[model samples]
Target: MDIFSNLWLGASTAFMPMNLFYGFIGCLLGTAIGVLPGLGPTATIAMLLPITFGLPPESALIMLAGIFYGAQYGGSTTAILINLPGESSSVVTAIDGYQMARNGRAGAALATAALGSFFAGTVATILLAVAAPPLAAVALNFGPAEYFSLMVLGLVASVALASGSLLKAFAMIVFGLILGTVGTDVESGTPRYVFDIPELYDGLNFVAVSMGIFGICEILRNLEGEHERSVGVKRVTGLMLTRQDIKRIIAPVLRGTALGSFLGILPGGGAMLASFASYAMEKRISPNRAEFGKGAIEGVAAPESANNAGAQTSFIPMLTLGIPGNPVMALMVGAMIIQGITPGPNVISDEPALFWGMIVSMWSGNLMLVILNLPLIGLWVKMLTVPYHLLFPAIIGFCCIGAYSINNSVFDVFVMAGFSVIGFALSKMRFEPAPLLLGFILGPMLEENLRRAMLISQGDPSIFVRSPLSLSLLIFAVVVLALVLSPSISRKREEAFTE
Candidate 1:
């Protein structure tokens, strides 16, 4: 089918009464959770995975996608009002958004974040539609060798873009490779690392690992820092933009959208990287550079727009090639697997309704977020007042339920609690959990593809270099590794990611 026909099919499915309602519910729940400190889309989606088991694939995906993008919009509310960044992507937003609020421009900052995000989401949705199909078409030509090379490039790119120590990220990737081996080998039917435990024959549960690392560990961290956060302004005034405000933001928003759309398509580059890059670029080239940390509207507009755009476009690789660009997309992968859908290039042809419907739901979710955030700003602010002591118990209880529901086994809950301790320790050591997740998600796929490539070549290592596409991908991976480890480039990466 042509593009228009595809969109029509998607619209019809997405706008069905039930699907639309689920999308709205996801946005509502996503916004509520994202406005709370320490709970981002990764945690939100991981905790909600089991609930989608009873729904149809299309409906389940529509809701999951809604939660991912809606959290991007919700995170700005906390950043602007209370100077607390609810998501890592919103950290830059807090620098200027909070300053604007302190200067009695709270309403304007919130409005800028909402409107800019809506505009960026609209653009990125279009990009996703135009870019994904062609990419998938190209991917249809891949052999096992090519697929293996692509996974290598993806893993290397993730390590390059990961925050903090490069060596540590590499270590995490190796560790994940080891963890991924803890199940029965597909070829040999023999357990590799299960230690004779039947429950682990399928490997560690995805829900258990994600919830413990993202949800339970985050809750533990937040509990230790309980305090009453103050809102800079009790009353938000003048939400509507003036001619001057509109003139100042137009270019920055467009530039940010472009940068974000590009970055979101790269491995490990999602809303967080896009926001940081946009902020850095704006600081260097913006006309109001001197006013950046002092309540500049451009600071609030650029990163907020960039992050939303990145969030939407990051779906491209996941849908087209079964590659997750970041941890949030990784959780979406888990959800898709739960629904018995394998993520790959063929999904567009095999599950067009699910693919197109998810694309359509992004636009609807963004629209819902704009409407919900603009008039109901005070409600989100009020939610921030709930004490931690009353909140964490519910979070832990829900995580426990999610872990157990994955397999109807209490062992999964124990596994989750164990990982929470590991996750907490890693967080304390300043290691980013995202690369570990990327490694974990890609490890099995990498091993399978590599084995296939080897068998096809009859044990010839030259098969990887003999194919032009495979050779090119490996060359690209080498280039990325060099750039990531270079002294000057590594220094710049550190500076860019500094909070």
Candidate 2:
């Protein structure tokens, strides 16, 4: 009852004319970018975060989250029509979807993807509303030691995110923690690594680092060569799925939705896992599993459903626990921090409108995407034709403007440029920069909580293990480490991400 009441309050805010407008724009932008091959939500969100600086936090988050899931909706179109996956989760969809297109069923493939995603997204929204409150309640009971241990668990889980070496990811996180320590010490008020520069006292600018790693470096990567791809849009006979097609997809859709909703709440690659796992499971259960790599609709239905559900539910940790599950959520965390709001268990009580409105907007945005994407599919396809050389310049301009506007300081611009090179170097070394952003974002909190735990225990080292909850979290972290290092899961994990 209370959840419903809170949702009602959220709907009132999210459905306000201006908030609805932001949600629509975000969905439109997300779909446009998703239709563009070689682009993803992380880069788009990082680039557009500056635009949301002046908006209300509720509207801003609504837009960002909308963009995130909207990409899923549009990714299928490209995957089906062009044999190219615009979103990571759309990879499996391409295996069957593009074949269907080649076989003159592009409409069927696209329609199945849209409908399946809608159904799964709706189910996952309800699940999120139901699951989030209990999770938040549990998080509220966590002591400083518990929080510290939880963060350690999060960092450890992120190490599993690396498609390559675990050691490299671990090194990147430690490097990020070092970057996080640049600001003044919260406890002593003494600067830790400021290099006597006043600008460094407040810590490295997150936007700068994020933009460098995700935005500017991406632009530089794009400029490296003149490779090009074209989107081919097939004329569709109808948008309607036949009765037999619906009957065939119903079971796979349900199963994928269930799988995705469960996996989506976990930290580290939940959406990606959901999509890949759904495809693998459907292949195992389908009567025509031999037809998988061809034009099997089950392949399209299952992974699309799972990916949408997963994207919708991935908001749990960031909203409830203050830990980002993926890079997109990390950008969301940075946006919230920039807006002078802290994310975590208290966000629901402290900023209920922002918390619940974002949830309601997700549902709204999903509906909007369904209506907008179907009729405007042509426009999204046309979007893929724009030249990258032109796009990168505009992105660079926006990045500079965004970084400079944060403090109206040129110093931030220089920092961003410097980090751009670092980001480029890290990319060359095959290091994943996302975990570092998580570390940088969580670093100060990690230190603060560790100190608080120590002070509360009168400097006893055993305080972390003394509390049952903290100890449990540490044990979970170890389990996560074991899972990461296990030869079997490691091979599967690599195979899953090979797309």
Best candidate, TM-score: 1
Positional deviation of residue 28's Cα in model 2 after best superposition, in angstroms: 0.9
Q: What TM-scores do the predictions have?
A: 0.97, 0.97
Worst 10 residues of 1 by lDDT: 228-237
Each prediction's total of clashing residue pairs, residues at least 3 apart in sequence or on different chains, is 0, 0
Candidate 1 lDDT, 299-416, residue by residue in tens: 9999999999998898998999998878888888878887898888989999998888888889988999999999998888888877667778888899999889889999999999
What are the lDDT figures for the candidates, one per model? Answer: 0.88, 0.86
Instruction: Name the top lDDT candidate.
Output: 1
Q: How many angstroms is residue 447 displaced in model 1 relative to the true structure, after the best TM-score fit? A: 1.2
Off by over 4 Å in 2: none
Off by over 4 Å in 1: none
The residue-by-residue lDDT of candidate 2 on 350-379, one tens digit each, is: 998988898888888888988887777777
Candidate 2 structure, TM-score to reference: 0.97
